[model samples]
Target: MKATHNPPTDVQVTPADLLRMAALYLRRHGWTQGTYYASDAPADNPTPPACVVGAIGIACAGHKVEHFADLDTDDRHTYLDAIAVLVDYLDDHYPIHLFDDDGLCIDDHTSPYSWNDDPLCTADKVIAALEGAAKEWDRLHTQGGEQ
Candidate 1:
């Protein structure tokens, strides 16, 4: 589960903060056992509650991770790595969460749709939109290219 793009280079939230928020989200979504107990599991038996896993997936695919360039490269790398691992974990456990009554999809607007009907183009769409916006900004600024 590679990231759709590089994580933001100016994010404000620390890795610790992301972890805490993720845990809180898990608990609020009824993944109490998974939220508090997952860290204790052995390597071969690591398992989060279905809802927790789904929430993680949604976070990975849709969460807003801010970008920050002030941090050292190592710190940014660690943050990116953490997100990658979470995405992989979620990918592996998707089936468990897809229909497990985890309440991850309580609102109709946010559900992950089937591939053919996916409303959230995610990676591709996001990049395209950003690029378009950047080009527009460049044009308006008239830095001597297209004015």
Candidate 2:
């Protein structure tokens, strides 16, 4: 019986790298909300518009966001950690929607995807969050954290 050879996964994709990749992907292609790319989004060339998290998943998975879930668990964990960093940043600095315009707090600990999907969450903000996460990891690495 012949043994099947599994193809190697994208093991080298790190959180910091993933953040930067997602940021750049958003910058080049475009940003969207509510879905992993627009419903009418094209397959390639245009590279379909995606939200912040969508971009991260797409970037890690490469080319298509559908492939993101197919990645090994380790890879998913590493990349998801990066996404968490962005969520943390949003929960800290953004969350404009969480406010009811009366300066009252609401929906505590809401999912970051809600923030990402917020109309107030612009592409620039998402890009900044991604960059911030990358810088944050970089700082940690410099401060005796994991590499």
TM-score: which candidate is best? 2
* Runs of candidate 1 exceeding 4 Å displacement: 1-21, 25-65, 68-70, 95-147
Worst 10 residues of 2 by lDDT: 62-71
lDDT (C-alpha) at residue 84 in model 2: 74
What's each prediction's TM-score? 0.25, 0.73
Question: Model 1, 6-95: lDDT tens per residue?
Answer: 766986543334444444454443332223233444544333432332333333333322242433575555445434443333333221
- What is the Å distance of residue 19 in model 2 from its true position? 0.4
How close to the true structure is residue 96 of candidate 1, measured as C-alpha lDDT?
20
lDDT of 2 at 28: 91
Candidate 2: tens digits of C-alpha lDDT, residues 1-147: 337877778556568888999999999989888887887775554478888877887777675555446767876887678877776666677744466778887766546578788777788988988898788777776667755
Per-model C-alpha lDDT, please? Answer: 0.37, 0.76
What TM-score should be assigned to candidate 2? 0.73
lDDT of 1 at 112: 23
